[model samples]
Target: MGNDNDIRHGRHCVFLMHVHLVFVTKYRREVFTKEIIDDLRDIFASVCSDFEAELVEFDGEDDHVHLLVNYPPKVAVSTLVNSLKGVSSRMIRKKSYPSIRRKLWGGALWSPSYFAGSCGGAPIELIRQYIEQQQTPH
Candidate 1:
């Protein structure tokens, strides 16, 4: 249920900002396993915490991921995206995910491109439905 009550209050502002983010693997390689996705979810949650944001929902396929983030007005989407992509890549690479390591030998986990859409004005249920519709590869 979407409501104005969900809006957050900062020092001088009250706002409700949500973004749907999608990131694909470098060259669109199928590198995610259940373990990898689990690790990534944790990583992304931590990153969002650092920025005082909430990672509302997260899901992924073998080669890409979708994130529903609720953030404050002060945070720039690009900066958040950069940190999410950068920190997660570094942390994932440090771990021993053999398949991912082999495919991402060049040291880049995500492609330079990403998809970001604001969901603030849309009804929360609609946003949730859209995210649920994301295709999960077998």
Candidate 2:
């Protein structure tokens, strides 16, 4: 079930938002081992904190990762994605993981394209119907 109390309070607003994010490796390389994935999960969590967001869930295959995040309205999604990719790339590469560095040529960890979608909320149709029923001034 979706969270009934997902609402969050900020200094000037209240909101509840969740996003599903996916990042694929460069050239779809199968580079991540179990240890690397674990490191990535930790890195993502730390990065989320910097943006006042929460990483609710994370999982992935060898070539990509899926992250569930709860973020505030004030945060730009693009900035978050960029930070996650850039920081994690640097950190992972710094570790000098031979397998990852070898497969990931061009010094890029993730492909430029990524997937992001809103999740765990009311259906769009329901919101549309509710809006249609509302009274408006002439």
Model 1 Cα displacement at 91 (Å)? 0.5
> 1-88, model 2: which lDDT tens digit per residue?
2565778889999788999999999999999999999999999999999999999999999999999999999999999999999999
Task: Report the Cα lDDT for candidate 1.
Answer: 0.94
Best candidate, lDDT-wise? 1
lDDT for position 37 in model 2: 97
For all candidates, what are the clash counts? 0, 0
Q: What lDDT tens digits, residue by residue, belong to model 1 across residues 1-138?
A: 368678889999988889999999999999999999999999999999999999999999999999999999899999999999999999999996998877877789999999999976777788799999999999
TM-score of 1: 0.85
Question: How far does residue 123 in candidate 1 sit from its true spot (Å)?
Answer: 7.1
TM values, all candidates: 0.85, 0.94
Which candidate number has the best TM-score?
2
Please state every model's RMSD to the true fold in angstroms: 10.5, 1.5
Report model 2's TM-score to 2 decimal places.
0.94
Question: Poorest 10 consecutive residues of model 1 by lDDT?
Answer: 1-10
